[model samples]
Target: MHTRFTRALVAVICCIVLVASCARLEVFATSTSNTKYSNLDSSKWNLVWSDEFSEDSVDTNKWSFTIGGGGFGNNEQQYYTDSTENAYIENGCLVLNAIQESNGEENYTSAKLSSTSSWTYGRYEFRAKLPGGTGLWPAIWMLPKDINVYGGEWPICGEIDIMEYMGSDRDTVLGTLHYGNPWVYNTGYYDINGSFEDDFHDFVLEWLPGEFRWYVDGNLYQIQQDWYSADSSGTYSYPAPFDQEFYLMLNLAVGGFFPGDPNPADWTSTKFYIDYVRVYEYGGDLTPDSGSSSTQTPNVNLLQNSDFTTDYAGWTTWSENGAVFSVADSTLKADIYTTLPNTWSTQFYQNVDVYSSTTYRVSFRAKSSVSRPITIGVEGVNNAALFNSTFTATPEWQMYTYDFSPSVSCSGAKLLFFLGNVDGSQNVEHTVYFDAYKLVYLDRKREYIFR
Candidate 1:
């Protein structure tokens, strides 16, 4: 399944620097580059492979079709097919079309294409015009050549998302990396002032031994260097998963986990257009450059007295319908004496500063006197929903960790835990204990110079 979560509405400020050794950079308003797709100097790269889509039909030697339905792990509504109506070449461009029709048990039809070739590390580029409408989720991504490289499927094998766009949000695109056994991932977004469907834009990814960089129209936006893979045996070494070869995939999904179902009256059809795809290998000298470098400050936990060491010095508790909250022995306890009418009727929270476009990792250890579920999330002081999820707490203490970005920035955002009958099902009185709370910002502030 294409695992995805609620998106944040924060803006990221990034700078682009082109050195003398690099090729001259040109800015475009709403079209692809007139010359080569890459902004990197010609002396630094070798074009290894490319698909210009000049022919009237698809080149089967370089691409293959994945045909099936069953949601493809994302609860998607489209049934992928090899039919020419769904995927074809038109006007010197590859078109992936999603249409409303009954295909088997699915109510929609679409197409998915996978590249026949795979590579370990290189620069991958795509010039494409995205589709628009609610419920359309189009993506250009990669999967490992060997799914069992890390002893499991999906996140264990690792996935790289060069670009993913939800049709409802026409101005933003996402670049993400998925790895780790329990499915850990990091995502960064690039937004434009206008819809992507208006013109073709260059989406590029540079994959090296220890780092991955994402760029849009030659403007570098996200850089990721830390990742790992593990399984039942033990944790693999650094970069063990991404170091392997991976193949490319392109698809347009209808109503998946990332994008909700489309409205039948509003959207019956949409098309994702691809002008070309290219891959390049570094051919220049491999040496440190004096022109550019990067330094990272250590991540800091922003919560005060997170462990309840001072007995809720920075925390507050609110209860309705006879619930109670207390702190002792470095643990915060919540007792639900009666079933609450709403999930937020009882809350334990702390006000924290939250910034736009920044990702935060929230972690805590918790257990319940009786097996049950609780709601945890971050919300604005005005009760604006930022992030929230229901997690079950067992009799034994278990560590829970999640990464999220707020849709809005707030100086006093509530970091909260709701200790109420989650869905009005568990009405019996129960006590939950929480400890070792932490909230850390996964700072992405860094700079890089191509050597």
Candidate 2:
């Protein structure tokens, strides 16, 4: 997944507040454990596949080489080849080496390998040590097995980036999901306290129906559930692109759009080491305790004056490009007089308390004088995004609903709606209206099922 770095949507300002209290349901798994894996519990997961890289050479039955020098759509400087000089198994690890030797028109040569097998939903993990040098880009990613299934290629078929590391920035790693016809993507990053080149670390992606979670060294960092894919006919149903089988890819690219051109003075060569690759599937059932059955409580709206009966009591509106917000006719109104640079330039939001692992629903009725798109999501006080989705607002009023669960508890969270021009493309003035905004807590019940 290659994309240009763009401006962030949220600007976090730290604030101290009282943490909200929440009650959690206790559930237990009764299955017996058999596996000896350290990070995974045998009662919940079953190892389905793995590659330890102990063989004397690259396993041709499991991996195939992708050889080229056309930059691979990223204007990269490296020419990928299957030569052992670029890729080979050494000391029980799969080594991918990037050398400065010229191969035809390209000034550098590297290697890329794709798994022969594909999978739909599972836990994918990679343990590896990253290479560091100016202009080096190492990645462990996935692409759909059938690219033409969802209309066209590339973004339409979807891409899951399990891990991507820049040689220059050795402390940060990115996990991203690429989808949508016009090419929309969501990315999450983890900042390692130390350089990734110092040692091998575990990068994992737990992908299930409609949900994707990313972790580094067993620490959960990012989660995303809102995405879409479309073609000539129309938008496919929820989770269409991700529902298909996808194969794994490992590559070390030199220079190009992501990390820029590598500086030859920084290093003559670098090596990426992979200790293993493993996959797992859910095996056993987890249910609630027999004495305490799952039950739902009455929904309680957490927002104040949601209907704008008197004024914007608990809501706040802000803009950088002179957009004005007011309460009119029992609806929250925004009048945009000028175009903005970013989608979040003109914003409307409210602070709310959020509980970890608890589900919350946001419902609202909205419309715009001119048809356009707006983004809505929940963000932490420190600017970490919990969930977000883009929606088109037509002249006719329509109801919108979103449900999400925060992975971590936050005393201060913002539920925001962004009405500025999306992608800096639309530069016209328009008015938008929001009414009947409601944020409610949805209590989840635990139900136990015997195996």
Candidate 3:
């Protein structure tokens, strides 16, 4: 009987030791194995792109500003600008502000930004809080990377609206796709517990070859697979637009063809905050891990302070021979008070991100006191010149455009605006003004201009 009692005692001690070892082993666990795949299926998914909006200002490298209030073919009333007052980064989120103000042509001003990157099939996710007010419409959507990726015009190419919220119906969030030969639209919406302005929520799109699923938080809200495109020639089969690559877009529109005007009392200033945008591709290291439930994302812009609205924030200046650089009236101005012609002594420059073997388009507005010439180009910050051109700036403000494609890839490329002509020897004193400098990655094939 004593021997039996001793055996039982020994077993108890063994079990205690085993429990202690397991507690210690937990310290060695890998973070990768513990990643949460949200509540949805993330099998074989790999994270491809993300923008956390951690910077105090928006990064211009991965995004391009889409400026204009041209109704966006929808009769939207808001005039979109690159101004930070209309769009900015605040408290770790992108704030797209829509306010009532007439720039003469439009009664409202808002901001729209588009991603420079495009993808085919992936899981696109975002965390956001909407701006609420009657007649306001905010959208997170995509258009075909190639305006004519399929044969024919838009809708044929396709459109994917991941999420859209209308101020008229502050509690509903919508998902939709526009396709077909004659341009038929399919859409669905889910009601939220409360106004999106009251809290942040997850908006996601799981896009596959033929099937597209829309979800709010973790609940599936919509699914669309059957779509068609009718063209002058013929109607394509299902998935014509769904099959091609598409680039993402974010905009807060006011008074469009869909939503009507707002009551002045209800049309106060409000902001749509986007916390992050994440893109995950299938067949990555992550498998449908049933353990995690969080998501974050990123998108970038190559140039900082391209608008010169932040007091020369993203620019480096240099001058000599009485040349001076300053910001006035929200424009970059260089006054070469003393005569020193053909010298690059006075310059304003910024280094931007670019990829090799890729083409980019640069456009800006500049003017001079006289018909003076200026040199603008893109080169490796400390390396070879990829693009350079000399143009004569007229007295009136004019838009100048040039296309650049680097043979070699680079991340920190220099965008130089030589205030004084580089090759001229005339010592004529003059002033030059610049504003609205925009650089964007171009898909040459789809440079068909627009969808």
lDDT of each: 0.74, 0.74, 0.68
lDDT of 2 by residue, 309-358 (tens): 86775565666677877788899888887556667767777656676777
Q: Candidate 3 at 233: error in angstroms?
A: 2.4
Total clashing pairs in model 1: 3
Model 2 ranges off by over 4 Å: 3-42, 285-415, 422-438, 441-451
lDDT of 3 at 216: 84
Q: Candidate 3 lDDT, tens digit per residue, 1-451?
A: 0001113343343233222221110011111212223334466668899899998887888789977755555556789888999889999999999888997589999888889999998999999999888878888999877776576455466778888877877888877776664444545667867788888999988887556777888877544444556577765554566767888888888875455676557754378999999998887433333211111011123466778775875565655445777788889888776445434556666655566666677788999886777889777522357889998788899999887777665443568887754665245677889997777766665553411
Q: What ordering of candidates by lDDT runs from best to worst?
A: 2, 1, 3
Better of 1 and 3 by TM-score: 1
lDDT of 1 at 333: 84
Q: Write the per-residue lDDT of candidate 1 for residues 133-189, one digit (tens) a residue.
A: 899989999988788777656667788999999898899888888787665555667
**TM-score of each model, in listed order:** 0.58, 0.64, 0.54
> In model 3, how large is the Cα lDDT of residue 9?
40
Kindly report which residue stretches of model 3 are placed more than 4 angstroms away from their true locations once superposed. 1-43, 284-451
For this target, which candidate reaches the highest TM-score against the unseen true structure?
2
Give candidate 1's error at residue 96 in angstroms.
Answer: 0.3
